[model samples]
Target: MTIVLGFEGSANKIGVGIIQDGKVLSNPRRTYITPPGQGFMPSDTARHHRSCILDVLQEALEEAQIKPQDVNCVAYTKGPGMGAPLLSVAIVARTVSQLWKKPLLGVNHCIGHIEMGRLITGAENPTVLYVSGGNTQVISYSEHRYRIFGETIDIAVGNCLDRFARVLKISNDPSPGYNIEQMAKKGKKFVELPYTVKGMDVSFSGILSYIENSVEPNMLQEGQFSCLIDRLLLGGQETLFSMLVEITERAMAHCGSQEVLIVGGVGCNVRLQEMMAVMCKERGAKLFATDERFCIDNGAMIAQAGWEMFRSGQVTQLEDSWITQRYRTDEVEVTWRD
Candidate 1:
């Protein structure tokens, strides 16, 4: 068996996985939550990746019961991520590849999510609603390729969550979305908020503006991280989070997809998953939610995507491949497409 060691040090997570054929032997992820106004910034993500690389990689190898010598190839996410973080992963993979004398492959970050979503849900050719800190896209298949039917013109769904969490003085220490999710679990009363979508594309910047200007300042900054304290301290977090659930459901509705697949870390949100479940059932469609490991960034997904690409002779050269901070879903040439 030709084992592929996958390394994904993109965004806030350090994902390490070992795969043979198409199966993941291990998919461990270590996430980093940036301070407010710093999410996905190159420098911030680099520090996180640097801090966790060795441990995360070792854990994955251990879980797979394979040594560095056993792997046939090393795969790492190469583009469409924070530059410094991408470089950090590249450095590790390059060094390992040089030492092991193994082949190296650079994978696309977004495609990893899609590939892993396909693996977990067994959804072939289903429409993908990929939303997270750096992306909000309504995608589907057409002409043998993944197409973006609609997407965010600016901010990503998870980024909005983190920024809003900061408003409530929520610490992203463990994870910002987790903090906001905790608060949303406790939030009650439908605090009115902005929901913006244009021609199937969604916009969260408006909502961010509304929250920053309209909501009371975060308590921790001046008082504490409770937006609900302005009204009722009880169940405020739940209420705020439910609002996000509602918005996502609304986006799904706007897409009119019967087979809805949600991918990304925030897609692991129970409330969000529940909301999608409810809406999908009501619409007579199925919703596939990747488990937490697949939901978060992971190297296995990158390897899965890379394997597909490699088989199709889509291997990228080090000279031609550069890190992309703003790659659109439509930019990739899908060789696997019909």
Candidate 2:
């Protein structure tokens, strides 16, 4: 049984995991949540990542009761996230590999989420609707690839929620998505919000502007668009989350798959799961969801993917390994199948 240690410093979280064969032995995360009123700054985010990666890595090793030298291979997220965060993981992995002479592999962040969900739920071939603050994609497994049949054309689903939450003056702690989910429960009216779905590709920039500007004028005139804002308060989050659920259900139907799998950070929402459950139940299709522990950005998924690849002798070299902020899921051939 080969043991693989994975590091994920993509986005705002630093995650580390240890996996043996296909079993996830340990997974831990350290988060560097942006305080408030700040977008992702490469330098700042990278520094934060560097600080957390060591902690999470140590935590994973401790949880698994193993040392770094015991790891047969080391894997890290190579890109599709902030450069600073990417560099943080790369530097550590590079140092560790050089010291211990372990095989180092760089994995794609997006595919890591999908593969982790597959490992957790044992889904052989399920259509995927992965929605996160940074990404929104409708995926299907085909021809040794997880193809993106549909995705966000502009602005990720999670970004839309974060920005909208900021407009609503909601706290940026824990997570913007979680805050929106809570607010939505208290929301009453369903004020109209832009819903744009074009040819399976979604866009949220227009909708964001519509809400921001519409409320801006109201606030200037009558002190606030109190009533209009109230309509959107919790109501907007529910509508947006519901819209995503509806789209995923439609995409699953289009794929003609009997099983649909939900992955990514947003998939943890109970509301999202409830909506998909009802839709899938009506169609006699199976829907699988990963728990919060496995959902969101984490190293368990990376370790899981690395374990499978390691078994097939698929490994990366330290000399030519590189990070990409735009890596696609279908680029690498998957060795595991159901």
Candidate 3:
């Protein structure tokens, strides 16, 4: 009968969600979008979150048809995100906890995504490929932690895509990465790009730099390079996704896992899901994925993870509820899972 209210604003989006036990009662979010050729700044993103968080919280409660006193606990992302945005969300979460007289819990953003994926897809003990604007990692549960098997040594895959979008001056309404994915579908040719995978880890910065330096200046002043842009977009996706698949396969083999679950914002990309599905089929493994609803960052994920933790007797004290910008997936004690 436990109910939890969760807040998430680790990056450009702010969300509020209500969860009762394992079922999500409501999940609502708002994204802070910048114009073309620009990435969101931390301060601006924080300001956007601060402006809309209260409204979103009201929306969540109304959608869930629950009163504030019905909630048993409050949860928020404790970070591994933009510092200002994370702090903004944490402030609201703490204020609500105190005003409502509820216990507070701090959750890892990565674990929130993982828990949400498992909840929506029902994949047990699967190898996880977590890709987002801020993170990229291959993980599996070992002993008591979600151990990282491989990761990006430089920028994340989604960050690489967003930077490339800026070079192309594409729209960032929904997201730069989403626009890139749509453009890539129209591509007919493949342009060679750098493929840098070191052992189990992958690197994306070199490839992004190569594209910006080598191909970006070739476009005509009148923007008549549509075909070339599509080619480059598709080629970049293939190369980067191949690198991810390679590392994920290696980790799956090492861990003897027969199931794969993809989580995070980039997991919403159809192309990445298709590529992973191909590998999963070849290896005779099952693939589990969620749509934009669960894949993209949201507060329901935080609530879900917090519900698990609270049920297992894990709660954060008010003095220790501060955010950590570099919180690793493996650092959480994972007391909820056997």
Using lDDT, rank the candidates from best to worst. 3, 2, 1
Q: What TM-score, computed on C-alpha atoms, does each candidate reach?
A: 0.86, 0.93, 0.98
Q: How close is candidate 3 to the true structure, as a TM-score?
A: 0.98
User: On residues 58-140, what C-alpha lDDT tens digit does candidate 2 reach at each position?
Assistant: 78999999987789998888877777778878889888888889998888888888888988898878889888878888899
Question: lDDT (0-100) at residue 138 of candidate 3?
Answer: 100
Q: Residue-wise lDDT of candidate 1 within 293-321, one digit each (tens)?
A: 78878888887887777667665565654
lDDT winner, 1 or 2? 2
Please give the lDDT score at residue 198 for candidate 1: 62
**Global CA lDDT computed for model 2:** 0.80
- Which residue ranges in model 2 land beyond 4 Å of their true spot? 217-230
Model 3 scores worst on lDDT over the 10 consecutive residues at 214-223
lDDT of each: 0.73, 0.80, 0.94
The runs of at least 3 residues in candidate 3 whose Cα sits more than 4 Å from the true structure, single-residue gaps closed, are 216-223
- Who wins the TM-score comparison? 3
Candidate 2, residue 52: the lDDT equals: 66
What is the C-alpha lDDT profile of model 3 across 231-250, one tens digit per residue? 56989999999999999999
